[model samples]
Target: MSIGRTDLNLLKVFEAVYEEHNLLLAGKRLHLTQSAVSHALRRLRELVGDELFMRTGKGMVPTGRATAMAPALRDALRRIEDSLGVEPFSPDSSRRRFVIAANDHVTAVIVAPLSRDLQQAAPGIDLVIRPSTRLDLAEQIDLGRIDLAIGIFSQIPPRLNSRTLMSQGESILMRKGHPAARRKLTLRDLTKYPLVTLSVGGQEEGAVGGFIVERGLARQSEMFDRRALEEALRESKQEPRSRVTVPHSLAIPALLRDTQMLAIVPASLAVALAKSGDLVRRAPPYKAGTETLRAVWHGRDAHDAGHAWLLERVAAAARAAEEALG
Candidate 1:
């Protein structure tokens, strides 16, 4: 195949299809229709004189030639991007769209402030946040779909890079007039009140240490330190009586209002939620261990100018959050 004859644009569709393993999904990521994506693939195959992928019951399976070509092709794309993107980003003028992943709590605590900052500094920049707790979050990052993920990630794969935003312990959030909101939270309060905790996935869902290892991606499933909370109760010769479980921190606010349920949540989330004035936060008696909120991204964007600027903004927002609740 002649290098001069190849259309570089087709490489993008190839990369997308290779990552997603499905034509429709690849099209969705590229903002192209299914027929367009298929047409591009057909053209690329004809140009290369090989059928790059095969349709299988499982998904689009790459042929041997395509598999062999992936590494160098990806590196070439990265090199091209780096060369073209090294210029300093002008936030005021750039209309860059960054896709970030975070749980609802971090979205509320971090992304929300970051969005406000961007509005003032870079009016044209847009932020798209996906749930970091999703099982496909790691895959999304691997595929370059998610530019950054901000959340408590216990385990990260080698291909990805991470920067810690803040370290926080657990705080109990309850309605302002709840029976225990008037005073400090005791382990007894944990045992007495029907506790509500966040669990995105669990042992039943093939998760270990609150993380589910799926297709080279270990994502957070259970949101809280359930083991520590349960162990504290067992050490006291008491059995846990967790009455409720919710998938997100945001859900607790509405559930706690006019109720006696207590939620063990990140201190930052508690502080942020307390701003509504309906919730009161207090330190939990048992050690919940420190959870680190981090910004994770694919190594491919390590030096991309726009990505770097967004990261700077994320770090600043984290610092601001820490100060607000410090």
Candidate 2:
């Protein structure tokens, strides 16, 4: 197709459809009616001479040709926007919607405060939080569906950029009156008492090298350092037994309320949960490695004024969380 014959607006519709996989949702994203979006799609399809998307029970699935065209089209659109110059972002007056991806723990520690800050500084803004633990996180960011993601990522592709939010190691949590809560926990205590740990992905999900890789981005699979725990268990000649392995960190308080189970979790989460009178946080018996919480976003937004403003608020919230940890 010749560039002179193609309407640039149609490319925007195509990108939205390819990212959302639903005509109505794509139309909402592009601020167009469904029929208008469909008309644009029809024009683009005729210009490209391909069935770009197939309507299915699930959604609008992209055809092979559409999939092949997506990456370049997205990059080119971003460049065009940059060249055209974005409007000044005034947080006090701009009514904008931003979507972010973050897991439950990060939602609790960082996003919670960020929301409060937004209420005061940018009340007209809306924030939509999606799960960062989804397997297709990188794909979502690449498509511009997610403004940013907050989590621990092992390897980030060059197409994306990241900034560390907080750095923390592992800590153990338990009921205040538990038998072992009176003293410092030892390696033997890990095996003697039933344990509960958080794990988002495991061997069944192709989790290797301590993370799960998708679309060239590697996200942390297990929250703790499994290698360190296993080594410690070997040295003590004790078999490790986790009575409960869960994915959600917020449930730890209820899980340990009246039980003997001890939970190994991120130090920041442990600190937040331990604020309640019933739970106490302790340093892990063995050397639990540290992990950095980072906010990742597409490199194309590096200079976008609105995106930069949101990231600054995110950093401020992270600082508050760090103070709470201390």
Candidate 3:
């Protein structure tokens, strides 16, 4: 097992394949043809005397050996790049593509502004947004497929770094002319009016407390504090009733339009949707706790020029969105 016997370039191919899980995609990432990628993978398999990856219907599934070697190898490659120094990132000319993970709520509230800023500042750069609510979100970030993730995460693994983008509380949304729209939201209204709430996953999906944990990362499962809501309901001697339970924030406006159903959602999202003039945002009667939106990324990208630029742009967009709520 001499280092001299192995072509270092082949390791890059392996890294791309491990991150992408598709030979064609790996080839695209490295600017190589699909056949060339296959050849490099074959050479590496022979050099290591093990089948590092197996072609399957879903994608190239990595073997146990490949999984065990991934973290260290990826970190070593990043270190090598750092030592050699990468070209300075020029936002005006670079054609680099950045992949971000976020739910529809963040996409509407934060990423929409970020996209507009990128259009003017870096026209050639491509942006791709994936759903952060996916169960494999942690794995995707760890594998380098997603450059950044924007969401409310309770626990982040030590290998990843996170920063708060904004903090928001729950707000009740209703149609403009609804019967209760003119008054402040109260506990009696909670039991009187039918409600609509957001829940991405529930106890059936292994959600504990109010979060769903995967790969040592915890994301909020329930957007609002269920305990606080229930306690307020108990004081009224009534039970909370949800007329509609939806998984997406974008669907709230439609679900409440021309209906009596009231929706409880993040204040930022409520403000964004209410701009259409059909909906209105109100503070909840109870002290609904606030949640902080955060941007999370791998430690390997901490010093990368392109990543830092994108992060700054995202933070600016978040700040703008937060200010609008005031």
Which structure among the candidates has the greatest TM-score? 3
Candidate 3 TM-score versus the reference: 0.88
Q: TM-score of the candidate numbered 2?
A: 0.86
The C-alpha TM-scores of every prediction are 0.81, 0.86, 0.88
Model 3, residue 116: distance off in Å is 2.5
lDDT scores in order: 0.82, 0.88, 0.88
Q: List the residue pairs that clash in candidate 3.
A: none
Instruction: State the number of backbone clashes in model 1.
Output: 1
Q: What lDDT score is found at residue 249 in candidate 3?
A: 91
Clashing residue pairs, candidate 1? 201-221
For model 2, residues 1-326, the per-residue Cα lDDT tens digits are 46886789999999888877899988887789999999999999999999899999989999989988887797787778778875467999876678899888899888988999999999988898999888888998886778999999989999999999888898999999999999999988888889999999888888996799998889998988889999988988887778999889999999998898899999889988988879988999888788999999998888778899999999989888888776
RMSD of 2: 2.8
lDDT of 1: 0.82
Best-first order by TM-score: 3, 2, 1
lDDT of 2: 0.88
- Model 1 is weakest, by summed lDDT over 10 consecutive residues, at 214-223
